[model samples]
Target chain A: MLEVSNLSVNYRGIRALDNISLTLSPRELVGLIGPNGAGKSTLIKAILGLVSFQGKVQFRGKPLRRQRQRVAYVPQRSQIDWDYPVTAWNVVMMALTPSIGWLREPDHRVKQAVSAALDRVDMLPLRHRQIGQLSGGQQQRVFLARALAQQADLFLMDEPFTGIDQKTEAIMLEVFADLKRKGKTLLVCSHEWGQALSRYDRLLLINRQLLANDRPQVVMTMENLHRAYGQSLQTTMGGNAMGFSFC
Target chain B: MLSPLLSPLAYEFIRNALIAGILVGILCPVVGTYLIVQRMTLLGNVIAHAVLPGLAIAHFLTIDILWGAFVSGLLSSFATNWIRAQTRIKVDAAMALTLASFFALGVILITRLESRLDLDAFLFGDILSVTVKDVWQTALITGVILLLVKLFYKELLFYTFDPLGAQAMGLPIQVINVGLMAAITLTIILGMKTVGVILVTSLIVGPAITAYLLVKELHQMMALGGLIGALSSVIGLYLSYFLDLPSGPAIALTVFGFFLLGLLLRPVCNLNRENSVGKKLGKKYRSQKSEVSQELEPDA
Candidate 1:
């Protein structure tokens, strides 16, 4: 379980995330949705302590930062350098880095875990290929393998579906379900809507602040969407009623 | 056939230079690979130039130039970070500004404080002038860098490839980052003896980039780049000996030549292979494309 209270992030005197609070229980998959610059990524970064922020984040009643090893994060694909000359196997092995003894190579068990994780994502056959040589979906899968290999209790993913093939999306959803079945917690940040929106058990609609945190159907209401998207929805309805209706 | 090579080995200066060059050959590319992967090759050049001020100050003060070089190199990097943090200037501009200011200060100090410091030796090194102590220093730095790299390869790999993920995993990324910068700086200082400040970046970047074009993995790139670097040093030394050219320039040019050759020849060589890696990659891609299309169908 994870809890945050009074979380605020400022960038050069501008409030990026303003006094947000939320909690996530185990065996739940929560989707974080917002318009561009809505602080979804910033909120995650604040929670992970990747960015400086004023907040209290706790995991299972302990300071989250102190219990970080129980957490696994998959950053936005755009945040990584695809040209980096590493194999899928190597990327997955990163999950076991904290456990490996200092100055020693990965042992048999480490290799086995990496192999099994890679196999779980159906990427074991391409394990030796350079990461850059893989497709976008394969690259995402490689990182999924990395998260699976972490064997963490909490998973925080930033835009795991962006620019990925449908296969990767299906696989990601399947993995999320599997993790939830195992009593793991997942917080997935996504800009997607429509059929994909129905998959999450709950949604946190936010724009610089928490607008709604409830079931997907409850949070996807027009009022919450208007609050998050702002005047754009009004403009759409005034200019193109059909378009607004489709939305 | 081997007499010319053996004859050079007889001279103490040549032996020392060769030892220094061989060590640089091994070290530069290893560090250079990190630079290339991080897209910080320009930072290496900046640190190289930035060391100039420190070198001049050390000469004026009659202190060890390596200490001065290390301090100035660290300062330049720190200054870049400071400027980026405090101003709207981007990293490239920050590095440019720091590089120019440091080099100008170094030049001013050298000209005004001491005219007989042999600035050329600092700018463009004289490999034949390397002493036994220089060899020992190079060895020590090399040992430390390689040992540290071996011990922290996983953390380094994770951080460089995915910094946010690494930080999220609770790795001390700030410490790792500072450590990486220090290692790169130490590498630049050690390389200063053979290639000097001016051409040392070539010694670092050329072989690594060349290896990058040929290899698909980081360790392979480092290994191949190391081999190319050492080979270039030996070949450059020989070219210098036989052609009566400046040894540092010769070595730098030779490494550049290697990079150019790899760039031009990789595709041509790939064209003739039985199971060309590129073709194999294409085959795998075609299969992935079909899988993607099949899954994309609405009914699926």
Candidate 2:
């Protein structure tokens, strides 16, 4: 479980996140959605303590900062250098570094975990392939496998759906469902629109501040959309008769 | 052929120079692999040139120049990061400014002091004149750096690959970064005497990149780069002895030569084509959203 209270972040004196607060329970899949530059990513970074923030974030009744090892973060694909000369296996093996300790090689047990993680994401066949050679979907799967290998309680993923293929999406949804079943919590940042937004158990909509925190049907109402998207929604709607199509 | 090459070991200075050169060759590429991956090659050059002021100050204070150079090298990298963080200037511009200013100060101090330090030799290196002490020092530094790298290999790999992820995992990212900087600075110091500051980046980046073109994994790249670096030094020293050329330039040129060879052999190695394919796939995925758009379409 995670609890955030009165969280605020300022970048260059401009409020990126303001007086935000939310809580997540185990076995929950939460989608964080907003327009571009809506500080969706900032909220995640703030919770992870990657950025300076004014707030208290607690994980299972303790400060979140002290419980970092229980969290696994999968950053956006753009943040990584695909040109980096590492195999898919190498990327997954990184999750075991802390447990294996420094100066020690990954033993049979560690390798089995990495292999099993890769296999879970359907990437075991390409484990020896350099990451750069993998497709966008494959790349995302490799990272997903890495997150799985971390065996963490909380998952914070940034844009895991972006640029991925349909198969990857299905695989991810299955994995998310499985993770939820296993009582793990996930906070995923997404820019997806339409019916795809319905996949989450709950939605947290924001534009520099918490706009709505409820079921998708409640959060995706016209009034809430107008408030968060401002004039952009009108332009995006483009005089559609049926209002904005769910797709 | 073997005799011609083996004959150079008859002299002690040549032996010392070869040992020192091989050590520097092995060390620079290993550390430089990290720089290349991080796209911080310019930082290596900045640190290399920044040591001049330290060298001058150490000379003036009658202290060991290596200590001064090491401190100065680390300071320049820190200063670069500090400037980038505190100001609007980007990292490249900050590095260029730091490199030019520190180098200029070193030149000025060296001139002002009119010290007995051979400016030309210091700038260009005099490997043939390396003493036993130099060889011993190089070996010691190489051993220590390699040991540290071995001990922290997994942490460094994770940090370099995904810094934010590693940080979130509570890996002490800053300490890891500082440790890497220290290793790089010490590597530059090791090469300063063999390749000199001016050509040190070649020793640092050349073989690593050469191996990068051929290898698929980080450890493989380091191992192959180390082999390439050692070979380059040995061959470069032989060329210097046989043809009477400057050792630093000879070694630097040899590194370039090996890089060219790697480039030519990349096709045969079957790595370059895969990279290009990956690029093509990336571009196609970016330009066309048809697959995603179709899947997202609501039921008719």
Candidate 3:
């Protein structure tokens, strides 16, 4: 379980994330959704302590920062340098570095974990290929494998579905289902819409503040969308598709 | 055949220079691999140039110049980070600003003090003039750096490849970053004697990039780059000895020469693999096209 209370992030003099509070339970998949610059990523960063914030985030009754080893984060695809000279195996092996201890080689068990993670994502065959040589879907799968290899209780992913192929999407959905079955907690930041939103047990609609946090059907209301997206939605969507009919 | 090379090793100065150069060759590229991967080669140049002020201050304060250089180099990097954090100026622009100001300050201090420090020697290192003590210092630094690198390779790799993920995993990313900066500064300081500040970036970036063209792993790049660096230094020393060229420039040019060779040879070496993969894909596409045509023939 994870709890975030009174979390606020400021960039320069501007408030990027207004006072926000939320909690996530085990075996739940929560989707974080909002328009661009809606502090979705910032909120995640604040929770992960990647950015400074004025709030408290606790996991399993301890400060989240102190319990970082029990958390796994999959950053946005754009955040990584694809040209980095690392293979999928190397990328996944990074998850076990802390456990392997300093100056010690990865034992048989460590390598097994890495290979099993890659195998779970159907990427074991391409484990030795350079990350840059992999397709976008393959790259995302590699990162997913890396997160899985971490064997963390809480999973935080940023835009895991963006620019990925359908096969990757299906694989991710299956993996998420499996993780939930295992009682793991996942908070995914997404830009998805329509029926796709129903896949989440709950959706946190945000735009600098927590607009709504409830079942996907309850949170996908027109009023909630309008409150979070504001007039930009009308401008971007030409005001004709204002109804939340798709969901 | 080997007499010409063996003859140079007989001179004490030549032997010391070779020892120092070889150590520098091994050290720069190992540290430089981090720079190349992070796309922070310019930062290496900035730190190298930033050492000038430290050297001048060290002379004025009558302390070891290496300490002064190391501190100043680290300060420059910190200053760059501070500027980037406080303002909207990008990292590259901040580095440029920091590099220019530090170099200017160093020049002013050197001129105002009328110090005995030779600016020419600092700008263009006189490798042939190195003493036994310098060789010993280089060896110690090399040993310490290699040991640290071996111990922390995984952490460094993780941090370099994915800082946020490493931080999220409780790796103390800030400490890792500062450690890397310290290592880089120490390497730049070591290189300052053999390659000088102006040409040191070549030693730091050149061999690593050369190896990058040939290898697909970070450790491989460092290993191959170390080999290339050592080879370049030895060859450059020989060229300088036989051709009567400046030692620093000769070495720098040798690094460039090796980089060009790597670039040229990379394509030829990878061609076979690429061609094989390309042929397989070509066959698959052709088969798919034929199958589609066969299916369409009945419809037509």
Candidate 4:
């Protein structure tokens, strides 16, 4: 459902990603694994078209803007400031903003969509609670509910399991399994290989470029694992002739 | 509306001053709400101080100080944006650069204007000499600014709360940011009359921040900030009347006092909530997790 080719990103004359190419098939559950500053987020942001990048990112064989309606992004929890008084409903309702779907006062369909999404993630009980009042796991699930409410065909989730309890992790895996069964595609970036490799059908190991993109059983070989997390590799965000892509 | 608060001499001045204070109060919170959320309260201080030279230069040139304040305030706001966009220097550093350089120039200009013109009245607002024309100016400028905020609140909230989401949604994030900067500039400019340039930012920031720490919701914060800001202005003015004190400083201090009281009140509530929620969730999560972890550990 998503294809990226020769992507490069430069921040202040330093290359964060260098000629990275990856792809996900329809309804595929793909895991992206990397160390800190491995261009995992850069790839996600570049795909979202939030920043400038080079190369190509196509979803459903169209540019990002044309196919943006079909894509959903669940950012890492640390990136948000939860102190701002917002409820789960507010967060989930963003799935339908500024469209024919925009509801000044939520209608039946909007409420149904939000509630169903929350129910899918096992968080219907927390629907009325302020997002700040939720636990870490539930907060991540809340964003997933929002993504699900968008009814998007593709989900790009970055580090959804960080600081979450085992129940949340189990819930996340169940959602992924369900998404796969329902013909929806997902690209999840994670650091926990033992759990992720066991769950996802494929894994894409990224460090500036496509280190390996294949079945997790094959790509996550001992050699690849050592190279990915071995002996403290120098990971500079802006480095050599590696970046400068726009898609 | 007739009130016992003013004599004929006192009425005209108080009327003008009250209009100015109320206008400043209303406009300050409109922008101050955003600033408080963005942690840009110090940025307001920088802009307030930076406009002094603008007012001083106008005084020296025998022109209107309001235009001078507007031009300088906008310049500072522009500079704040430029500095943030250009370099890795933190926002505070950029603010310090603008504040020191601009205010020092204002100090020199005011000294020069002092010899050639009556500048002390503008320095510390001689609000008691306010004319009907001044009241009209306050009403017109503040009215336009507040109208802009009312019209653009949704767009502003989108960017202020979710910049990444707004950009993804294809909103002009830069334009909205610039619009907010403009609102903040107009607020600081008009606020200078009631509180003077030196303490204008304190008036802008004090009550808004107090509400920020005390309130959890965005709409509540805005409402509380406006109510507190207007209250402080009226009460401070009254205290200055009875105590025979400097009105601007007295009001600023009162706002600061309210902020301190609100700050002290916060921890008590937070600590109580934290204790109860932690105890409740801790037991439930632990029992649930142990049961699940056992189920997962079977293959080993």
Report per-candidate TM-score of chain A alone. 0.94, 0.95, 0.96, 0.89
Cα lDDT of model 1 by residue, A49-157, tens digit: 9999998999999999998889988989889998898988899999988878556789899999999999888777677767776788888999999999989999999
**Which is the winner by DockQ between candidate 1 and candidate 4?**
1
Local distance difference test values of all predictions, in order: 0.86, 0.89, 0.89, 0.74
lDDT of 3 by residue, B86-184 (tens): 999999999999999999998988889887888888888888888999999999989999999999999999999998888878888888889999999
**C-alpha DockQ for predicted model 3:** 0.45
Per-residue CA lDDT of candidate 2, range A1-247, in tens? 8999999999878899999999999999999998889999899999999999998999999999997878989998888999999999999998878889867889999999999999898776567678887788889999999999989999999999999887889999999999999999999999777678879999999999999999887888899988999999876556452533442
Q: What is the CAPRI rating of model 1's predicted complex?
A: medium
Model 3 ranges off by over 4 Å: A235-246, B272-300
User: How displaced is residue A68 in candidate 3, in Å?
Assistant: 0.4
Better of 2 and 3 by DockQ: 3
Q: What is the two-chain DockQ of model 1?
A: 0.50
Ranking by lDDT: 3, 2, 1, 4
Give the per-residue lDDT of model 3 (tens digit) for A1-247.
Answer: 8999999999999999999999999999999999999999999888999999998999999999988878889999999999998988999999998889878989999999999999899777566667887778889999999999989999999999998887789999999999999999999999877678889999999999999999998998778988988888766445445344655
User: Which lDDT tens digits does candidate 4 get at residues A135-199?
Assistant: 77788888889789888888988888788887878888888888888899999888664434657
Q: Using TM-score, rank the candidates from best to worst.
A: 3, 2, 1, 4
What's model 2's lDDT at B178? Answer: 92
Q: B226-272, model 4: which lDDT tens digit per residue?
A: 77887787777777777888888877888898899888988886677
User: Candidate 2: which stretches are off by over 4 Å?
Assistant: A235-247, B271-300
Off by over 4 Å in 1: A234-247, B268-300
